[model samples]
Target: SIGNVLLLHDLVQAIPGEVVRWALLSAHYRQPLDWNQSLLDQSRKALDRLYGALHRAAGVETNGDEPPEDFLKAIEDDINTPGAMATLFALSSEIERAMTAGDHGVVARAKGELVAAGALLGVLQSNPAEWLEGEVSDALRIEVEGLLEQRALARASKDWPEADRIRDRLNALDVVVMDGPQGATWRVRT
Candidate 1:
């Protein structure tokens, strides 16, 4: 989720039940979905702030956050960076402005920017192991090399169990080991 508060607010609003609180308590901290008093207050305040901004932009709630064409270009350039996610929020303001003025160009630009931002986000968050050359890291390379050596020795000694064990260990670490005519080849599992 982009922000813990935003995600939680969305969930609570969508599903009104007491069991959700229990689920939040049991979730891992990395998947932070808890709802504290401050977050609740902040969520409410955020809604108010958004309403005010929209009201100011259009005498009523109009188009949501959308970016202009120029803004989309910048979003494309830096969307790989983690900070770009938050920067995209500005699109909401631009959308409201465009709607208030009935500017088709601005609306189109904002739509393009929103699309580019979404695409960039998807690409950045996708698996990055496919393009590696030698290895993912020095440590992982060393570990896999050691395992491959052990695998070879096990095969020579006719110890199929040992060779299988080595492969299992590598598999647990997201490394797939393949035995081929040239020897063992390994690649990271994306």
Candidate 2:
């Protein structure tokens, strides 16, 4: 049974990182972990690392640098992010049900594993609407929007250098600008 679940979890994790997060969210909402300790450790460590950068940035000292407010806000938002706590509780409840039903002995041995999976799932489930909000802020959006607006002007003026500069700015923000027959369009790189 543990092996079966391991295979399942592995399969889930093997998918795109976004998919893994979504699946974890689903799993957290449906079941509770009761399996292996090692799995739990791994999951916890991942969460620690994933949020560490944001947390560290949040604690950054301006040191009279006068960093823009918008930049500071973005870091603060990431540091204060709230994920799927509800899903984890739901998952734990499901596990309790399984245990009560005299589920396989494998589950008993894999208690930590189960919790780890649920925790991992919880960590992954973030709101898609609020997702990119943490990365690119409203200020950044305004800047991009202005670029898109001036795109035609930049091209009409035969200012290839300026156009390329705008494109480079997008690239710096992890946006890939593509030049096609239909003109330039951009997408998030990752």
Best by TM-score: 1
1-190: candidate 1 lDDT, tens digit per residue: 5554446566767532222432332233345455665544443333333333332333223233443455455446633232343444565566557765777566555544554554543321212122221237888888878988998999999999998898899989898664533455566653
lDDT for model 1, on a 0 to 1 scale?
Answer: 0.50
**lDDT of candidate 2 over 1-190, digit per residue (tens):** 4544555557556433543443343333335644554554444444333332222222222122132333234335442112333333333444344444555342232333323433433443443223323356678767776886576579889998988787778778876554433344444543
Report, for every candidate in turn, its global Cα lDDT versus the true structure.
0.50, 0.44
Alpha-carbon shift of residue 110 in model 2 (angstroms)? 46
Residue 176 shift from truth in candidate 1, angstroms = 0.8
Candidate 1, residue 82: how far the Cα is off, in Å: 33
The TM-score measured for candidate 1 stands at 0.31
How many pairs collide in each candidate, listed in order? 4, 16
